[model samples]
Target: MARLTVPLVLFGALIALLLVGRVTSVQAQDIEPRAFSNAPIGVNFLIAGYGYTRGGLAFDSSVPVTDPQLETSSAVLGYARVIDLWGQSGKVDVMVPYSWLSGTAESAGQPIERIVDGFADPRFRLSVNLLGAPALTLEEFRDYKQDLIVGASLQVSAPWGQYDNSRVVNLGTNRWWFKPEIGVSKAVGPWTFELAGAVTLYTENQDFLNGGTRAQEPLYSLQGHVIRGFRSGVWASLDVTHFTGGRTTINDTLNNDLQRNWRLGGTLALPVDAHNSIKLYASSGVAARTGNNFDLIGIAWQYRWGGGL
Candidate 1:
């Protein structure tokens, strides 16, 4: 036990230092793009290393129960590209994400906890923008001093990760899920506000683990930001999610009981260059099953570069 302490402590300390630097050097609300020129083709990449502190289970109508603190972490990478349209003002963007999860969890009264490590399910999303800004705008609409933009998105979860088939923290569900959503954005002066919502259609999971079931899911998000000026901005965003639609079937019998969960978080962004940015965020659950309430702290560095010829 003592032998493992040094590495874990070092990792935690490093992340802590980064967070401190992010918080003290600048305020999250002051980053912004100086110009809105559309590029013919563009690419963006994001890398995030996250830590999850609490681990527990929340069942229908039951308070959450915590066994032990399961220190888990994931390294996620995403890539997106813009498809040129007309010039650069309008475009289509598609992104893919891959991640790895590792950690250990212990029960409250249990003497020991188990180690968890595996690849996460891959995710894909596509978006198409209409009436893009800073590139092309209808003369009539432009006169209204309105920065209206609309888009649609489709996302899918592929069951391509490693799975224990009996544990809750597996990489794949062994079943596929998909979602469709619409988004709207507007800019007023130096502020930009966005709203998006989606619904998930769940498929049957014959081998669902931990007495799990398949169900429909709903997600909604709202983000608002004010760019104090170019290259700096303070932004606030909130997201809400709900899960319910599947039956708890045990031994071919249905247990009408359903499970639900939710999360909310906010972040501040600062640009280090034309293609690089830094963000600091803190999140926690408001109301959740007893074992479901936990807090999260994170920092992300993003870079946008390269694109199609």
Candidate 2:
């Protein structure tokens, strides 16, 4: 155990330093592109952003609500680091979000409304390139071109946000979730194509609303992206996603709410300088499962350093 102390301390310090730098990301219904791309070891990222949504805001689609007319404004900070893992390229990252939500909905045939603000669940991820990417320095990374890369990642969302047992709509779920995913990225000329599949498993929320216990089945998701890159350090992508199968049970009573939803979005990233970049993104639900219809638009700024840069 003593032999592991130094490495653990170093890793903790690394994450602390990056968190002090600030960063950003989205959590639910995630549709991120280039998530598995390789980067030079030791490179660090700082991202900060804000997002606005109209219609609904439920971490799980089966929130037992109907005809929701809601809006959410979210602010997030995130950080990421590239590391060398067993001669392969890997990354560790985290994102935290704070949200102000205002909404109205019908529950059990009663009209309800709430205006609330608080921190949302934070997410952390660890990813490693399994094939077609090797650990490299900045110099080696400059001359490298990607063809086919396969990667795997695990993402976790912790129950660190505010939750009210009396309110049906809140910023937190009072539960934990894990997502294990595998992805493939292929670069073709100036275009890149990527696909990912994941399953999100949830733990029971013991202190659910009305002092009842709540449990959910796993949710499965698949997403695809088509990206175009230019020589001017600007890139864009079209994204689509489908997720299904999150049936909820409350107090031994099974709810008829099962989720099958689809969303479409796009992202544009423009590099302003060697250390600064800007990103614009938008997504809309094409098919929603009850309390899951929403439209989102967001913009973020990113800063990169280290890795001898």
Candidate 3:
């Protein structure tokens, strides 16, 4: 009986590993912006006009169910600066978002009020460049024109906004989150592509909604951009971004993972002056399961107002 039980346990463990890989496949591939090389003691601002919608969610062994559709709009002003510590190449990023919303919905058959307000959340990041621009050779020719940056970043969230334990659209989380990230980017021809990923760790949330306790879940995203420079210092690109992730645990127990979220969008670069440009984009939430899904649109403006050192 003991020998039979040992084999069965090993089989079960193998199955669990396969399921875990399937669920985290997309989460490990998402891409995000690399703040290490973008800012070095300069101030850049990001203005976001975004929305979200959630209708039905499909969880483990469960059918799809209708959920509320909520939407919101907001503007985020963020700053990224390079911090030189220990004589290494590192940087930090900070963002404060002021949001507004207008929508009404019913959750569990109870009506909920719409909201419209402004709030702030701070993000901190640190990175170091490793092997800046590794050499590549092809057909007896070598190319080493640009720098390739690979670094790690850590971000934290602060609870300083209006949040009610029963409100789903609150702009804040009462718990702290830590995310470590890595990325690589380099310019080739007229296009520049960037790859980045981050995994988040959730601290204890005594005030989590639904009286739920959750575990650390890693979110994955990936993006690619093909830019072509036109006359007059203007450039445009077709940017494709893919994101996928779900919750890992709830109430200190592994619950059905949250529904995965997917986004599709495009960006157009508009040059304002010799050292300034603005980006406009719009994205749609393709499918959602655990909550309402909404569309998102936003604009970002960046300008270089100082030295090129």
Candidate 4:
């Protein structure tokens, strides 16, 4: 029975690991599962991963590029720790990513292309399960079973990536962004159902497109997941997400590029042993209103320690 609990605890790391593969800011569309899951207190996780994304640049609609397609390869390093918040289960995690991209498109009826490589923005997140999950030690967790859990999270993107105002195709946004989310998770037998909602807000980019100031409206998103868990501690999930409302204004001039998009994704997590796990994931854009779409695939390896294991 103790062996059954090992992989389950590491499921939460998939949120940060899979997220590192997506686009940035308003173009960032992702599907995550097991976000509200629980783990023993004092557990630490180290993860290293690689991903490849193929899709349109999905630039802020204000840009006049057309028929844009890009292929990007990225790598990320991440860390997470489970904490105790007044008996409630809590987590804090961070990820840093680097990427290389090559693409081509047409702007104003003229052909354009770019190939670049550099560090992308880094993200940090804090999450807390407000109900159902408890902060238990490894010994106490052996008997724990999830019922219904409610959780909240806040994630921030720092503008510390490689960016140049002179180039339209750079690896960084040179702006800060924030996302606040709330979610619920319910377990029935070996199946879990999860739903979450979030809003992403962006700060002004004073140096966009060579000293051009850019601002964007808030983007709202909703996601759902269905998961199946096996006794061997392996799990698989089906995920879907929809998002809308991210129009941009450059130099105080508003643009009419409101967005509506849908995405589908899947995840498979396998625990090799008590301390190591591997995850494979893929996502694709199903529908897009403003020409923003992408198909992404990635893999990650996680190692766990502490928690008195």
The TM-score values for the models, in the order shown, are 0.63, 0.91, 0.68, 0.90
> Model 4 off-target regions past 4 Å?
1-27, 58-64
Error of 2 at 207 (Å): 0.8
Best by lDDT: 2
Model 4, 41-86: lDDT tens digits are 9988887887788776532333435677878888888888889988
Best by TM-score: 2
Lowest-scoring 10 consecutive residues by lDDT in candidate 4?
Answer: 17-26
Please tell me which model should have the higher lDDT, number 2 or number 4: 2
Q: Please list the C-alpha lDDT of all candidates, in the order they appear.
A: 0.42, 0.81, 0.45, 0.77
Can you write out model 1's per-residue Cα lDDT over 52-142, one digit (the tens) per residue?
A: 4344321111211234344445454454444545433433322222333334443333344446556555556555555553333322222
**Considering TM-score, which of the candidate structures 3 and 4 is the better prediction for this target?**
4
What lDDT tens digits, residue by residue, belong to model 2 across residues 219-280? 99999999897765567889999999989999999988788999999988776656677788
Task: For candidate 4, list the clashing residue pairs, or say none.
Answer: none
Question: Candidate 1 at residue 220, lDDT?
Answer: 30
lDDT (tens digit, per residue) of candidate 3 on 1-309: 987755444432221111110001001122232233323332223322332222321111011122444455556555444344444345455556665555566644666665657573445555555545222211111123335656566766666655667554455555666767677766666555666666666566566566665454555555555545443434555545554554556466764546465655555556554344555555555554445444545565553332221
Candidate 1: give its CA RMSD in angstroms.
Answer: 11.8
Q: How many collisions per candidate?
A: 15, 5, 16, 0
Off by over 4 Å in 1: 1-40, 44-53, 56-69, 85-113, 132-146, 210-262, 289-294, 307-309
